[model samples]
Target: MEHRISKQMIRKIPYFEKMLSHECLESKENKVVLDFDEQAFKIILDWVERDYTIILIEMDYAFDLYELADYLGLDGISKECITYFHKFTIEHLPIIIPKMAKTTKFMTSGALDAFICRHFLDIASSFSKVNRNTKKTFWSKFPIETIEYICALDLMINSEYQVFDAIMDWVLSDSYLRKCHLERLWKLVRWCHLNDKDSSNLVNHLRISAGFEAKLCSPRKADCDCVFNRAKQNCFVMIETLDIKDLRVKVLDNNFKLLVSQVIKEDTSIASNFFHDEHVSDILFDSGRRVIRIDWKQNKYNWAPPLESYAGLQRRIARSVEYGGELYEELELGEDIANGFLLLESTETFDLICFEGKHLHRFSMPIHEIYKRFTTLNNCEATLLNNKIYLLSNKAILYEAHYFL
Candidate 1:
């Protein structure tokens, strides 16, 4: 059996044109036999004929088409493949990354590579959520270079422990030979990010292994603002107004476990919300656009000088989030930016807005309507910790919580 296409139409592609133009076997015989996906070849023909109405591509086949298009020097389809991949969810990454890593074209492009690194946390977390067998299978098939790139990323939101667990899982899957990679991979884990107990345990366990050595040093000082380096250090601070003059401050870890709960006397009217000072690592409460120090360790809250009083202060935290982009969708604009998402706050709704140029991806949070009857985002003190948004009401109740990507 043979598929016949117009020679003129086929030659529109550079790969086919070059082959047929020169004194090649295809040109001499006036026929070309090629091994490729039939659907992809048909799509290429449709592209050549400008038959836009009949051309349709699916996610699974897009990769095959992309590889074939790239091989055939089809820049239009190659760029389309890149655009398709940009819309990929975290789950799609584990499937595509291994393939991308092996392709030289993908390596040279570096666009998709950066996407994987940027969303490394979601990808790693997706791995963790899967069963052990599935996770092992994933890591076993993953390219070492891609894994190393993910491990070495300074932009990850997942704790270093998760990164350590992922690498160890990969090593333990094929311990005999892969163990050699353990030392290099172990060095990539940001030891400073691990808690005291976990760090000590890891050090002790590795020290017992013969010929294992590493420098347990400071936290990774990344240039970009990741969730870890941001003002909120993976913990949400909830400000609760108790009576007229006191505010109860509670610090909750990523799991919403209470780490610190203390009541301090302050003018609750003015000190309604808080912001982070990344430089000093302080959770300073905002009072009339001024800074106030609440030394929770000492169980005291004191008013500090006005923000202007601190002359030459660089990187001042903005009192309000500015919504400057064009409204691409009909959803209400958000009042604050958390985890790189704009949030719309109102008594009836809480929404997460992903404002990409000329487009908006709005995620309406699943807050019970009954809760919305009495609760409002404006009335709650909102904070982001470990990629989850926490809305704590003035009454000290956990109003609503949602995870943002």
Candidate 2:
């Protein structure tokens, strides 16, 4: 069986153009036996025949189409394939990664490989509680270089021990074939991020293993205590009512599990207070522009410069929000309060503007109307805590806006 395609359509594909050129033997003979995925080739021919317009593509055939398009130097089809793959969720990773691992060329492109590396932590966390054998073999399909890249990433969200465990699991999946690469991958682990117990465990493992030596290396640049602690610490909310001495505090983890709840009676007077993830502080804003932070736990005081005074030290704490913008130009509106949202407060209304640069919040409801769903509004103060909006009132009432999540 043979299919006839116009010369104009054939010229659109680089492979066909070059093969059917005047200098080629196929052009002189006016016929050529081409070897390629027949289905993908037919799709390409249909696309070209229709004046190179975009066509609906089946996701199942995208991989094969992408490979043929790449071989034929069709940027349009390759881009379409990449766009389709970009929407893959965690469930699709196990299947997609193994297919991608079949060729090193896929890893070199940085399009799909970088996506996998960036979301590797999420993917691993998702499978942390699966069957032991499944967890151990989850990354066995990853190529050596891809694994090496992920191993060396500045991933401070989890402990280095998890990273080490992941690498070991991948290696032990097929020890006879993978054990030789273990030493090389082991060196990429940031040993400084390991806890005392994990460090000791690694030392014990090395004592038993052959051809391995410990090397001293600096911690990964992202292993700073601030970042490490941020990843480990849960969000905390400190509620202050009109009664200055009575304060309530609650700590919640990422999943909104309440870890701690306490009520403290103190002689201290309240001013402009800053609610942080770890502690509560009564900040003193003065003429000198100095901000004093009080550690509620130890009753210790520390003085730091006002963050707004220095350009580099400025934080996103917007007090007001303004709206006006056109296409391609977003009018800079309010400052950041929490998680990139601006709190819009007024006498009649209180609302949050979900700030996405260039993509402004198009709709807003009255703040008091929103408050009606949770609690009665009576001179309430709003602040971001634990990734939710806390509406505190003078009557010692606490209301949480879970819609933020």
Candidate 3:
């Protein structure tokens, strides 16, 4: 049967091209019966006719309206329906994201679903600590894309353990759909942060791992500070550096202006020659412990390799505490770093320094970790004060210096 609509209206969607079919052309009624919801079609018809007000009036029925638009080849209306859903998600998505994810209705690869998921994913980090309800959504028909995105965030998770828990929940929820995503998601977890205690816990979960390649992945060294970092309530990242060569330890404010210039009579003799051909790695000043271990990375002899080689030499090593630059004890290190940068009973952990004001490493992780691509920054001078590492990176062309969080 022929449709009463004009050629212009039918041309908008290819689905209506069926009007030119042999049976349709031969029919005398000049009419067609569509196998779609009449209620949804009426709303779409209004939009097609530029009755845009019907969208707001029938906004609550957006899922159905969008379905009808998609089925009937009404992309214009479908797009508008996506815009309408923005407010819905921003206003209501947090509480319902997981619940809705499980449904085949709007959450199953449709324009509306994509739009909502994208918006939610963008602000996922801003989610106030994951609660019981939000956690439920993790195991629901959560979008695999959202799962991957969350895994990649630098600040989204409070605990890698919780993330592992979520994965376990997700895999158990409906293994058929999510099993394929296991290994792909597993690599994103920062395993090295967990100590032997926590790393051992992951052993059971690794059994079902579907996608990890043995040779392609390696965990970080035992010294990674991820576990300790998770314990911090708030990080005070504002501080200045101390000129190691000078007798006085200089303290700078956030703007890098010299705030306090005071002399520390720690036997300059030992610290003086120490800075000549050496790079200060870390300065541990626990006055409470009455000892300062000035760490430096240098060309130390390692006879383990072929007669003239240093292959297995421990590159990152620290010395014992000293009194007034004079030694109190000999060099000490088995696996030197403990609890990462927050040293033993560390009241003040200072490791940052500026050599001639041109080079520095701020918040530097281990060099071995850097080589393994486990850390983005290789090595830089750092000092810890109150469990906070004051890292320095010189910008000679810019201002003298500045403290930034």
Which residue pairs in candidate 1 have backbone atoms (N, alpha carbon, C) closer than 3 angstroms, thus clashing? none
Candidate maximizing TM-score = 1
Quote the positional error of residue 59 for candidate 1 in Å. 6.7
Name the regions of candidate 3 deviating beyond 4 angstroms: 1-46, 49-53, 56-83, 90-139, 208-405
lDDT of 2 by residue, 1-405 (tens): 477877767887888888876588778767767677688778887888888886556654667778888888988888888766544443444445446555523233233444444335433433222232333333565678667766655543446666777777778778889888887888766676667677778967855663576653544555433233312532545344336445555557777788866665543343222223234453422221345545567544444444322211111111111211111213332332222333332211223434244343321222222222332122434554444455444555665554331
* Candidate 1 structure lDDT: 0.52
Q: Candidate 1, residues 225-296: lDDT per residue as tens digits?
A: 223432124577887878876878888988899998889775333322222121112334331133555654
Error of 3 at 311 (Å): 58
Score every model by TM-score: 0.41, 0.38, 0.31
Write the residue-wise lDDT of candidate 3 on 170-195 in tens digits: 67568777787777777656676556
Model 2's TM-score against the true structure: 0.38
Who is ahead in TM-score, 1 or 2? 1
lDDT of 3: 0.39
- Native-to-model Cα distance after best TM-score fit, residue 325 in candidate 1, in Å: 34
State each model's CA lDDT, in order. 0.52, 0.50, 0.39
Off by over 4 Å in 2: 1-114, 125-137, 195-197, 209-211, 219-405
Task: Decide which is better by lDDT, 2 or 3.
Answer: 2
RMSD of 1: 17.0
A best-first ranking of the candidates according to their TM-score comes to 1, 2, 3
